[model samples]
Target: MKIVTLDAGTLPVELIKPDYCESWVYRASTTEHELLSVLDNAEVVITNKVPLRRAVLEKLPSLRFICIAATGYDCVDIDYCRERGIAISNVPGYSTRSVSEGVIASLFALRRNFNEYVRAARTEWSDSDHFCLHKSPLKDVQDATLGIIGRGEIGGAVARLAKGLGMRVLFGERPGQSVTREGYTAFNETLRSCDVLTLHCPLTPETREIINRRTLSQMKPGAMIINTARGPLINEEDLADALISGRIGGAALDVLCKEPPAKNNKLISLPHSNLIITPHIAWASETGVNNLIKGINYNLAGYFGGKVKNSVI
Candidate 1:
């Protein structure tokens, strides 16, 4: 059986061994027009960040399975693939530990004003007056409320770490959905009450722009927001406005509407000490990448053996 990986560069180098499959073709780039020609005879296709829309899939008559390298399959046209009898599978829970660690880092960075403190520490400001530079105030995380949206493996891991730090944890309920968990609260209520809010949910139709102007208005005046999930999950412009107006204390995002946006994006220009944006590196840890590779291999083996695992559609 032929197995073609459109963007194998995203996976770890060690994971792409010849022993994993019978026949393999790897390419770093697969343009829309070139995709059909590349995978015409393949039985299985693997992709990390490439899109597999109905237009591209319709041309590949022999394609039987799709192995998405990530947990979210928004890039694929699931309904169309289902109609074509193509099986789709995705990797899940691979980045739980990596993303949980990133959330903790962003939380502490904002709470303690670490960036400002570090800058002051490196300068000669300490020689002028006090023992320690008091440019920005530090806040303690102990006894603070941590609101978690999406109670999946990543969110659960984050909650566990927060509880260990003596934080009160409150899981947010889905909109129009009742609070079923013991300590769960209404989504907006949790947003208003928590000192720090973190998002780990997938970007579905309902979850798109979950943190926007209206929701930002409901948050505590000095609440901090952390998002390592999909970019569209939070409206970028609205978030920048909230930070500028002090509606929310600060925000740390690892994803953006555009990956490596152009030079003049508003979020990049929002010159507040409170706003921090990393270039979507929350899930790029070495350990997490290795785990993702294992998931891909497992799914590939299952597909070739005529059994399906991790099917999203």
Candidate 2:
């Protein structure tokens, strides 16, 4: 079977070996026109971020399967693929640990004022004062409430870490369901009470813009927010306003509405001390990348052997 991986450079080098499949071809980049020729007779196509809409998929009649390198399949046209009998699979849980670790790091940075303190120490500002100056104050995590929006694998992992840090954990209670866990509380109550709020939920219609001006106003004063999930989950403009107006203490985001943001994005010009923005690298850890590659190989072998794993369509 012929297999073509567009944007193979996104995958770890060790994960895409010739021996992984019987016949394979890889390209670091594939343009819109180039994709038609590259996938002319391909049976399987692997992609990380390339959009596979109905218009693009209609040209690939020979394509039988799609292996999405990431868990989210928003880039693919699932309904179109299903109509054409093309199977779609995605890698999941591979980046749980990596994302959870990023949440912890961002939380610590915001709560402890690590960045401001390090800047002060490096700029000789700390040395100028006879006594150590607390330019940016730090908060103790112990006894503080940590509200988790999603209680799935990554959120649960973050909860464990919060517990280890001596912070009380509270998960959002599902509607029409009992709060079985001691740490779980009503979603709104948790939102109002949490000292730190971390989001690990997917971006669905109900969850889109979950953090808006209204919700930000409901949060405890000086509360910190961290998001390692999809960018649209929180309204970017509202978040910027909250930071500027001090509705909430601060925010650290690993994902943004636009990957690099437009040149005129207001968030880019906001004060750096109250906000931390990363270029969506929370799930790009070496270990996570390797696991994702392994998952792709497993799914491919299963498909070729008449068994399938991780099929989303």
Candidate 3:
């Protein structure tokens, strides 16, 4: 079978070669026009973030199976693929630990005043009136309330880690829910109560811009937000405003509404010492990457063996 992998650069390392394929081709990055040529006659396609919606998939006459290299398969057009009989699979729960660990690390850095102290040590500490410069507050992670949105694999992992540090955890119910379950708090109530809030939800119409001006206004004055989930969960302009106006204390975002944000993206141009933005590397740990590779191979093997593992359709 002919196989083509588009945007292999999304993964930090090379994927294991599938021995069963008769032909294999890999592209470091594939653009819209470029994908047309690369996928023209492929029986199988492996993509990390290069979308394969109906517009792109319809032209590929030979395409049969699609193996998404990540847990989130939002890029694919599920309804069209289902109607067209294109098999789809994804790697899920592969990055649970890495993403959860990243959230925990960011929480400590933001709450414990690590960013402020690091900058202050270079200049302010040298000219301090006392032995140590203490302009920024250093707070302990323990005994704080941590509110988690979408308590799936990664969120559950975060809850376990936070509880170990003595944090009181609250799982949030859907936004605007009139009644909450026994374990879940009303979304707005969770926002008002949390010392730290982290997102692990999928991106959908109901969840897009879940954190905006109205929601930010409801949060505690100095609450922190850590987003290792999909972007668009929080509105960038609203978040920038919240950070600048001191409505929220801090934020660490691994993903953005736009990847490799434009030069003039609101968050990129905004100046805020409390806001930390990493280039979506929360799930790029070596172990996580390996798990993804294994997941893909397992799916590929299952498809050929009449089982089809980790399918979305």
Candidate 4:
């Protein structure tokens, strides 16, 4: 078997190789322009972030399998893979605990006013007449309603954890979906009712920028937004504007529309004290990373042995 990993650096740790395999791993990222040449002779290709769309896949006839190194397979063209008889697999639920905990952490950080007080505690406390400086309002998670979009494993896990914290959880139904389905609140109702709105939905034409100016206007003026989901789910410019205008209280994003965003991404340049942006690491707990690696190997082995796991198409 021949295996070629377009971007091995994505794993950031030692990885296991399949037994008796011809393998090549690239430390640097391979662009769409460079993908076909690098994957020319490979029977199996492994990728984390580099996209393999219809145009790229059409040229690679040797590609019998695609092993996605991460949970999301949006980077690949699912229909093209199916048409080409290429087996595709992703490592799902591997980062469920890691991401759910990260979302909870972001929730507390914003709601408890930790971001404001952390910077204030350095200077304001020294000049304070009292024991503690009142930099901002501190809200308790116990009474706050957490509205979650996307009811996947991560969302369900977050709901369970938030309920344990005494939070009122509302799972948002699909947008424009009128009939309230079982175990779901209407879409606009979730937007209108939440104290903290978090997105766990995938990115698609319908879902991209679901949080635009109009939707943000529907949310509570003080509601905080946390996106550990796909980035483009929120309109970056509109999110910055909402923070500036006090339409929303705060936001912490683990992903952006563009990774290592252009020097001019609206959210990246904002000076809002309530906004926090972490490199896309919500799903990158050390344990989660190892589990993903194991899952990738398992999927690869399974496909060759007569069954494939975690197929999106």
| Prediction 2 TM-score vs. true | 0.90
RMSD of 4: 1.2
Tens digits of per-residue lDDT, candidate 3, 157-236, equal 99999999999999999997864477899998899999999999999999999999999999999899999998899998
Ranking by lDDT: 3, 4, 1, 2
TM-score of each: 0.93, 0.90, 0.97, 0.97
For candidate 1, the per-residue lDDT at 37 reads 83
Q: How does each model score on lDDT?
A: 0.87, 0.84, 0.90, 0.89
Q: What is the lDDT of residue 308 in candidate 2?
A: 72
Give the runs in model 4 whose Cα sits over 4 Å from its true position: none
Put down candidate 1 lDDT per residue, 1-313, tens digits, no spaces.
7888888766557456446567788887677778878888898888987889988888889899999999889989999999999999999999988999999999999999877777767775758577666766788998999999999899999999999999999999987688777767999889889999999888899999998899999899999999998888889889888888888888888988887687899998877887889987788788888889889889988886789999997
| Steric collisions counted per model | 0, 0, 0, 0
Question: How accurate locally is residue 278 in candidate 2, as Cα lDDT from 0 to 100?
Answer: 85
Candidate 2 whole-model C-alpha lDDT, 0 to 1: 0.84
- lDDT (Cα, 0-100) at 85 in candidate 1: 94
Against the true structure, candidate 1 has what lDDT?
0.87
State in Å the error of residue 74, model 1. 1.4
Model 2, residue pairs in steric clash: none
For residues 1-313, write the lDDT of model 2, one tens digit per residue: 7888887776657455546466788788677667888888899998987888998899888999998988888889999998999998999899988999898888888989887888888886646756676776788887888999988889999999989999989898753366777767987788889999999887777888888888888898889999998889888898888888878888888888776688788887787676888888898888877888889898888888787789997
Superposition error at 251 for model 3 (Å) = 0.4
